[model samples]
Target: MPGILGHRASLPRQLAFRFLPDGTDDAAVEWTYHDLAEHAAAVATGLLRRELTGHRVVLALDPGLHYIAALFGIFQAGATAVPSFPPTGKRALARFLSIVEDCAPDVIIADTRLADRVAQFEAELPASAARPHWMFVDDDWFRRAAGARRPDGDTRATVRTDGPALLQYTSGSTGDPKGIVLTHDNLVSNCRALEANMGYEPDRVGCTWLPPYHDMGLMGTIMLAVHGGWPLVLMPPAYFVQRPYRWLKAVTDHKVTISVGPNFAFDICTSSITDEELATLDLSSLRQVFCGSEPVSRATLDAFRDRFGPRGYDETSLIPCYGLAEATLYVSGKRTGSAVKTVWLDKAALENGRVRHLTAEDAEDAEAADAGRAARIVSCGEVAEGHEVIVVDPGERRQAEPGRVGEIWVRGPNVATGYLGKPELTAATFTARLADPGDELTYLRTGDLGFLHEGELCVTGRLKDLVVIAGRNLYPQDIEHSVRSAHEKLRGAAVFSVPGESGEELVVVTEFRGTARQLAEEIDAVRDAVTAAVTAGHGVAPADVHFAPVGAISMTTSGKVRRDATRKAYVQGTLKKLTPAADALPLSVR
Candidate 1:
């Protein structure tokens, strides 16, 4: 035991056991380090008896002590853990089966509910191939497993640090999901980096309701708690969705110091909380509210702070961050106690590959200048320690200047190896370079578009998601923001880039807060405003503008807007809408 194994050996002894305060069966449910170690050994022995070693194991259990025990057990058995969301429908189940076939896991450990689902999948899978052995997370299994002896030596010794520890499947952003291979070193390095970046202490406590299937939920919250020996309070994602303020109340109840989620969670919490609820909630212990996994909206952050600040929520605790699964978790985060810094830029300059700063007064004079200006696109702070981030041209051959927008590339110990079983894509994405003398540099090509200003990373938009029209790059965020701001009736909108017969076109999908006829007028007003804004601001017009009821937008398990899926649904005529129309082209184009 050397680098990380040495640290792991002492963790059980040094750390304290703290379960979810509100929801456990009994006081005995709180497992100590010695108890966890013994349980892990029992699961490991059980797995070894089944001849399942050095293979992938999938876990589809809800958030609880057993789920945590299963994860540690898989690692203790020298196997890779593939944690995924429970299959929702036939299509999603088929996709999971396809992934299982590809990965060829040795066993599947799921809750009783999920086991039934797997049994249904078994009926469909061929009999020739080796079917995964199923293990149900139940009281019988726990009782039988608890009394087993602990493994003598390091189970992780056989597992190299460079080898894969976790297989995180992407949310089918491009198409079908592909597992991202993250190594032990990558995980440990990121945890250590984030711990340092967030200034985690031994006494700190974290509360999260994010689904474990999401990268941020697993790596950013769960693993970080384990590695740092912090007390963690876990809640079901459904619980949070049904009552968003429960997350806040949980924090208030537990005196939780840290929490994190996407922008939508904040929006939900702000929208759902009544004034009386806010008055009773005490969030004084809250220090860091990390926001990421989607486009971070300053408006959402500001509204949440304004609504809750009176109830002991600190406005300075707002920490807007930037990260993706490819890089493991976080890349950059704002410093604690700092207001989120946002810049307004000329929209035309941004579209035409130019970055020009604009002031509010200057924006009103010229439409191009107004179009050039983007608002409250928060600065995600400087690169994390032990990481190097650079903005490069589309080809990734040359570096971009400070004020120019380009693709973001990162070289760091925290970066993952690549997507599992996709060698061509791995080669395309991860590259060896000699950017500096004797550098031996390896960089991960993030499809995110951003730029560096005064050594800080400002994420503009996704490279693939960028809408190129009339030789300009129109980011979806800007379009969505413009449409939402255009009408008081249309709210909670998402704009996406849709391909048309001619080329790429902008599609604005909004949720109307009124009746259909009134919503139609509001939509028309949005369309006109968006068209004028895009034409004046970015020299392009939207191809179509659509209106739907509230809650029409699709989100991932982590609450990220599924722009690609939304576009697909719209193209297939599957999207439900009150009124959808093809708008007139920009006057400049006609």
Candidate 2:
């Protein structure tokens, strides 16, 4: 099996970037295959000089060309790369420290720009934590290392095919982050599976503004482009957040044929981009726009199409895919050339762990087609080649019946061996087996609730995130979406269950987007609307509707609403209340 490093000599010199320091594409940096290879070789020389081979090297740099160089450099030096978010502020620094403690890296490589913050982070490290060697990548270091060459031997022999290549950490939406151990074979196999599943053209150009530290950005885009031998234009996630239009503009300007983003990105583009900006985009060149890392919203997909379709954005270009860090990113992606498929099912039946497709007759029946009775689920396409995906009854540890929602289990070369340094968990999660006889393949339990409809995977929700009240399982996303739709002022919403006098009660924490005066005037009305929406949609009224300050809702790095974390904040009374006046709604302190 050829690893990523093997492509160093075979790939074309085309990957480029438009450096946007001040949100302007003034500096054009075109990095070719040779350029990246040479830079990576120099970085490898630097690492080898430090005797850091076969060690964990954590990257704490901004998303850019230098980060890519450092990643391949670690591969060339036979060291495991741990891509991490830069410790820019208190929150990020805390997460970074937690990752450092978890990985216990031998060295920490960061950009020179983070010198001050890095020093502070180092000082804050606990006494029990091992002090890691520090190296900073900058123009000066690159200049000094440029003269160094690859070790005198067959360059391909530098990295073992089955050895650990990366420690891709989870985003920790549910719990603490765990490093998924991906070997060189896993990386190459996943990239190949992506290519096999989603046919890649040699002349294809890619673009992305996703955070490079995450799996979708690193393996899905960066590593995939390298393996596919294509050019990829890059930009920081902050720039995209500053203006969602920049992402499409880059796609249009570069004639990008492939791109990837989460569901919130399309929603942001739909609501944020003006008609003037929409007119400037020519998204017809995009053959596939992969959406994953969170639930793919039907409303978002339809709205994005309705808004951008006139501007040549192909409806068929948006592909809903399913994947995670444990699968080395690309799991299963919708094939191109067809519009995305969505199945409207009875919400009650779905909540009961069954797939009941809503028929036209059901729609005609007024009582049956009540508001929120139908749940629209988007198909995540077929399993990748050489992979087996099965819905397993988690409790029974047996294969789920047809059309029954269960934990998605995957077995393939793309699946990672296990979580790093956790044997028991690794066995429990990555070595699952069915109860049926004559079935011997070990499967990785995805912990996602989904069922196969026809041949397509329709993900319902996460098993742990499901809210069971009165024996009815409610997906938080459905409740959150309803709450957001309840009022125009409602922006971000998180729905979770809390211990009540009863078994559990639903709590809604939301952020409003209007002035404080406007909120004060509409506070009572908004609360009433939210309560009605949740009650009508899920048959469960929220015990309390709390209006939080802007940015109060906890979100994962990949833009998922961190319901569990937000619940913790709600219980601790740490959530910032949106109090406009004396008559404002009182905080429902737990």
Best candidate, TM-score-wise? 2
* Backbone clash count, each prediction separately: 9, 1
lDDT of 1 by residue, 1-590 (tens): 12332355456464434555344213324555555555566666777667566789987666766777777778777788888655566545665676676677888877776755666788776676579888787667778876664456433336687888888887764346678898888888888778767884556878888878689998888788777766677777777777787788878887889999998788778877888888879988988888888878877877888888888988678788888898888898888777777766676678777789877666545534344455446788768889999888866456787678988889888888888888988877877453456656668888898888777888989887777776877777767766666766667666677667987777877777766556444554566776776566455666777777776776666766677777788888887787533343233322
The deviation in Å at residue 135 for candidate 2 is: 0.6
Task: List model 2 lDDT by residue over 552-573, tens digit each.
Answer: 8988778988888898899999
Q: Pick the candidate with the highest lDDT.
A: 2
Estimate the Cα RMSD of every predicted model relative to the unseen true structure: 4.9, 2.6
Error of 2 at 569 (Å): 1.0
**Which residue pairs clash within candidate 1?**
345-372, 345-373, 345-374, 346-372, 346-373, 347-371, 347-372, 347-373, 371-537
Cα error, residue 333 of model 2, in Å, equals 1.7
Give the whole-model CA lDDT for all candidates, comma-separated: 0.74, 0.84
TM-score of each: 0.86, 0.95
> In candidate 2, which residue ranges exceed 4 Å CA deviation?
1-12, 16-24, 148-157, 173-175, 364-369, 437-439, 583-590
